[model samples]
Target: MAAYLKARIDLGTLEAGNKLPPTAALMKQFDLSDNAVYRGIALLKAEGYVHSQQGKGVFVSDRRRLIAGANRIKGITSPGESIHHKLSARVEAPDWVAADLGEGECVNRVRTVNRGDFILQASQSWVHLDVAEVVPEVDEPQACDPTWQAIYEQRSGNPVGVASKTVDARITSAADREALGLDADFAVLVMRSVYVTGDKVIGVGEGVYAPGHPLAIA
Candidate 1:
């Protein structure tokens, strides 16, 4: 099945660009019927793990692309890697943002995250301005510092409990095209997340990622 093949792929047993076993061989090895084997192959193809040719066998897809996930609230960056970013403060909270953080009570920080020369994601984080006394960094640009959730927890004296996210795809705008090195036709992934500590919404973030960047949720 797809799970078996994925495990092999993840373990390096089935390398990228390597052709999968023929239909009969796969069916025999897995004790699967023709339909079951094809279904499993179809699932893998749809998941971007493999591709099939008309008469040829299926081959694994390349997995070198960077993956961004919904659970990564702190943003993506390697250990000791400085995240290149441009940070700005928004004076007026957008209507939807205000609804999440109380009307006229939210202070917003927009961060455009980049890796080297390529822009990876653009994130807008909102927190109540009242907490500025405890988390003064929220008003300043952060090159590399504690995460928003950490600051909120420090001020509120409550541990973050859960994070909820919604993911969608949309066509890139002119600004996104230039910042993310993408064409107008390409689509980007947008993930909106709300970090919560008990019943309190500690922070809200909207992150937009460029196309071809894989996303894994765990």
Candidate 2:
């Protein structure tokens, strides 16, 4: 039963935000008992294929995917896609962040990337205080110009030569779940990136993408 439903979702017979038929209807169609039908739904939910809304129904989750290059120099944004960044104040780097950017040598800048009403990802960037001061806009919340590489080059005159990224699966945090409207217990893809020029780590960016949004190699 779960296999049948998964095939439907994969083929887009059932699309994102499309509610699944009621339990009785599914039970009738699949010749399943009430418990059997629910168990199948539970499996789909655990696999991030669907989400249940209180008083509404279970619906297919969005499978909108994005691609990130192996050596991506910029933040991932599709062409002409409007991304708004809510930049946070420069603060002392966290332990993990300091480890990457060097303790006491880094300042933190955070942003929430959004496209229209949909929240795409939340990013926290760590850069040297001097670089942050030079860019200035890193501290200002505003719409990004397609990519961060462009902004950084224009502001700092330093082009990113190479970037390395690592992707992992993790449970969503309370704040990220609220910001991205993620379903309960859904896992998110965490991409940690390091932008470099020569041997210097110019910036470190960590982005959390909601479930159903897989990252492909660009």
Best by TM-score: 1
List runs of model 2 lying over 4 Å from the truth. Answer: 1-81, 105-107, 143-157
Clashing pairs in 1: none
Best by lDDT: 2
On a 0 to 100 scale, what is the lDDT of residue 32 in model 2?
Answer: 94
Q: For candidate 1, lDDT tens digit of each residue in 1-218? A: 78778756643456568999999999899999999999999988876678887788799875433122222322234333235445647466678766766667565776665656566677677776755666777777663244655656656787663356677788877866766666566878877767667776756778778666545432
What shift in Å separates residue 72 of candidate 1 from its native position after superposition? 12
Query: Which window of ten consecutive residues has the lowest lDDT sum in model 1?
Result: 66-75
Q: Rate the local accuracy (lDDT) of all candidates.
A: 0.66, 0.66
C-alpha root-mean-square deviation, each candidate = 12.3, 14.6
Q: Which stretches of candidate 1 lie over 4 Å from their true place?
A: 1-75, 78-82, 178-183
Q: Among all windows of ten consecutive residues in candidate 2, which has the lowest summed lDDT?
A: 66-75
